[model samples]
Structures are given as C-alpha cells and as structure tokens.
Target chain A: MTEKDLIDACKRKNRQAQRLLYDRFSPVMMGVCRRYIKDPMEAEDVLVEGFFKVLTKIGMYNGDGSFEGWIRRIIINEALMHLRKNNQFKYAEEINPNLDYTEEPTVLDEIAAEEILNLLDEMPPGYRAVFNLYVVEGYKHREIADELGISINTSKSQLILAKQRMEELVKKRLGRHEI
Target chain B: MKTEKNISTLFQKGAERISVQPSGQAWQRLESRLEKEERRGRVVVMRWVASAAAMLVLVAAIWLWSASMQQHNFAILDAAPPQNLEDLENVDGCEPYCLVLKARAELPAYYANPVEKRN
Candidate 1:
C-alpha cells in the first residue's frame, strides 16, 4: 500500500496496516535507538514502545511533515526518556577539561557502518547521547542541552569528548584490521 | 588527516545507512501490548459509563423522594382543621406541642377534642 493509504489504515486502527508500518520503520528506528541506548535488549524495548505510540497516536499526525521524520522524533524522544528515567544524564554535565585531543589524524571513510555503531557503543552513555544528538541528528548545542537538560557548554564539551573517543576507537579498529 | 567536519559527516552518513532487523519476536510483543492497551481503554470507557448511570439513578431517587415528601406534606395540611387563635398563640411557647395539636385535629370527630369529647 502507498504511504498515505497505510497511514489512513493505521488511523482506522487496522491491524494489518499497523504491522506493515512496523515492518517498514522498525529497523531504522532500532538503529536510532541503539545509538543512544547501549544495550541491545533495552534498545529493542524502546523501539517496541516507540512503534506502539506511533500506531496508537497516528491520529495526531496532520501530514504536515515527512511521516518518517515524525516517527523518528517520537522514537528519539522515547530513547531520551528511557535514558532520563534511568538517571543516565546525571553525570553527563561533568566537564572534562583535561581530555586529550592529541592524535594522528586517520582516514575515517573506509570504516563500515557497523564498526561506527560499535564505536558509539564503546563511548560512555552521556558522550554517546551528546554525540548522536549533535552529530548524527543535526541538533544544535542549545537544543541538545535542552533535550538532555544540560548546559550548552556541557553539550559542547561532551561532543568534543565523544569525538575524541570515537577517533581513538576508529584508530584502534584500523590498527586491528591492518594486523 | 580528516577534518572535524569530515568525521561528523562520516558518522551522520553511517547512521543514515545503518538499519538492523529487530528480533523476530519484536512484532509479537508490540501486538500484545497494543491489545492490552485497547482492553484497558475499553475498561475505562465502561467505568465512566457505569459512573454516569449511577449518578443518574441517584439523582432520580433524590427527586422522587423529595416529590413524595412534598405530596405527603400537602395531604396532611389539607386534612387538618383550620388553625385556631390558641394554637397560633401557643406556637411560639411550645412549637412541637402546637404541631402535635395540629396533627391531632385530623382525628375522627368522636376523638376530635379530648376535653369536650369526654364531657
């Protein structure tokens, strides 16, 4: 069915349409959730809850923006909520001014997507959240601060820490591949 | 040496390209949750409907009780004899006794005035 038809069927609470929508969006949404939530099981839980919300609250979508974008926002919010509920953001505001940025610049183009996700998973939860928000999601520092309830400077610092950590991880992975 | 912008672009592109198939049971779990929520919603609506019906019954009962009381009061007033000056004067000093006298006045003629009937 067309996206419009699928959405209309979902609005009518058609079960089959809801299943098709889930099949279409869950993979991408799961990937989005996994970036913020480290545990695979927890990420899947968040994904399920997000899709449930989408199917149930489908009536609120006024067709103003891209449907996928709207769904992505809801899933992202759910992942953020899971983090907040677990007090994961408690230590996210700590500014690590002593973080080392000294590293040999390495080529990042050859790294696979799965390897990138692994790099994200290796980072601390706070750094991962900030990095995914600022880098992947294209959110401004101010918006990231508001979403994660941290100050703008904290958001900026977290991004720097996350980047340095990701670079280190990438370098480590490249060294292993070269060996 | 990749620039900071290049790293950001790489991560963003990687994220966009990434899509992992969820576990096979993911859909089943979500379907069950949706059904549970639907059942919960139905229960909530039923509770609201029951509460409204109960309120309607309570209001109707109150209305009927008050209406019956008004009718009984009017019947008593109609059957009782006209108030006398003595009964009206005694009302302030002995309101309850006056009310009792008013009720006694509704008795049969043979039992009407205890003092005069005995004589």
Candidate 2:
C-alpha cells in the first residue's frame, strides 16, 4: 500500500495498518534508538515509547513532508527525552573544530555490529548520548539544543569532544598506525 | 582516518538490523488496556452531555415557573385594584372615597376632567 494509505489506516486506528507500520519501520527506528542508548533493552523501551507517541500524535502529521522523516524525528525526540531525564547532556561552550578532527580510516568496511557496540560500550554515558545524537542521528546543533534544552554553542563543542573521543576508540579497534 | 564513509555502516549495522516486538499475550494485554481507556473516554463524554442536558432542562423549567408566578401576581393585582390600593393616598386624614364623605372635596381640573365630571 502507499505510505498515505497506511498513514490513513493507522489514523483510523486499524490494527493491521499499525502492524504494517511496525514491521516496515521498527528496525530502522530501533537502530536509531539503540545508537543513543547503549543498552539493547533500554533501546527497546525507548522504541516502545516512541511508537506509542507516534500513534497518539499521528493526527499532527499533515503529510507535508516525508512520513518516515516525521516518525524519525519523533523517535529521536523520544531518545533525547529519556536522556534528558537521566541528566546525560554534555555541555561545552565552544569547540575547536580542528581539535575534534581525527585522521582515521573507515571501519564500516568490515566491523561487525558486536564490534561497534563494543566501541560504543567503552564511552561514558554523556559522551555516548552526544555522539549518538550528533553523528549517528544526524541532528543539527540548533535542533539538538532545542531537543536537549542546551545551547547551540554547547552542542557544537560537545559534538566536537564526542568525535574526538570516538576517534580514539575507533582507531584503537582498527589498529591503524598512521593517520 | 577522517573519511565520512564508516558513518553509514556504524548506524545501519547492515544485516544485523533486527526488531523484537511484543508477543501475542502482550499484544492482547495492550488491546484490553486500550479498550478500557476508550470505554472510559466514552463514559466521561456521556456524563458531560447528560449533565449539560439536565442543566438546560432545569434552567428552562425555572424560567417557565418564574414567568407563570409573575403572570399570577399580575392577575391578582388586576382582580382587586381598589382593595390593594385602599387608602393609598389620604387627603386631610380621610380615605379619599368622596361618595361616602370620607374625603369629599372640590376636585381640581387635572383630577376631575370635564369629561369625567359627575353631573
């Protein structure tokens, strides 16, 4: 069925439509939730909350843009809310973009999910949350500020620090000697 | 190195992307919960409507009763204008019933219009 048709059916509170929606996008959204939260269990919990919010707030989606994008934004907000409750935001006033830059190789070519999780697991909670929000989730600094209730400058600096930390972890795993 | 290539793979996790949803029992529980919530919502709405209707009926009944009371009061006033207005005004300590000599006096032109003069 078309995306609009599915959206309409869901709006009508049809179970089949809801199931189809879950089947189609749960994995993608779960992947997003998992990145922000290190615990798979917690990620699943966030996904559930996000799904419930989407169902209740479906009326607000006006079909002006991509439906998936709308849902994705909701899921991202769900994750951020959970983190905010836990006091997991990292704030740095200004980030030297150069300081966060790392001359590292791409690990995506061969790294497994377990390996990536392992690298993520090593970081502290605040760093982990910021890293997932900035790089993995693709939220801009202003958007992150609004979501996390922090300043834009802080968002940029935190992202820079997160990248600097992630760079070291990825390099250590990949065992690369030179830049 | 500083290439943006690995970012996609980091997020996607490729074929490992799997979803775990609730079981049949859990889904049934959720459905039951939702059903209860919907029923509660309906009851609340019904109660509000019923209360509003009752208030409307009460206001209409009170208004109708008040109008009837006013009409009755007006009837009583019309039925016995003389008794109720008895001695309402006294001229020289006498009830103004001139025929019985209670207050017989020369009437002024305004009070005794020529058209109403008793010949």
Alpha-carbon lDDT, every model = 0.83, 0.68
Winning candidate number (lDDT): 1
- Which tens-of-lDDT digit does each residue in A157-177 have in candidate 1? 888877878877777766623
lDDT of 2 by residue, A143-167 (tens): 8778777777777777667666777
Query: Deviation in angstroms for B69 in model 2?
Result: 3.8
Top DockQ: which candidate number?
Answer: 1
Q: What is the lDDT of residue B30 in candidate 1?
A: 99
Task: Tell me the lDDT of model 1 at A134.
Answer: 85
lDDT of 1 at A146: 92
Off by over 4 Å in 1: A90-105, A176-179, B1-5, B54-119
Model 2 C-alpha lDDT per residue in residues B1-119, reported as the tens digit of each score? 54345543454444234334443343344345546756887899999999999999999999999999999989966774343334445644334444444333334544666566586
By TM-score, how accurate is candidate 2?
0.69
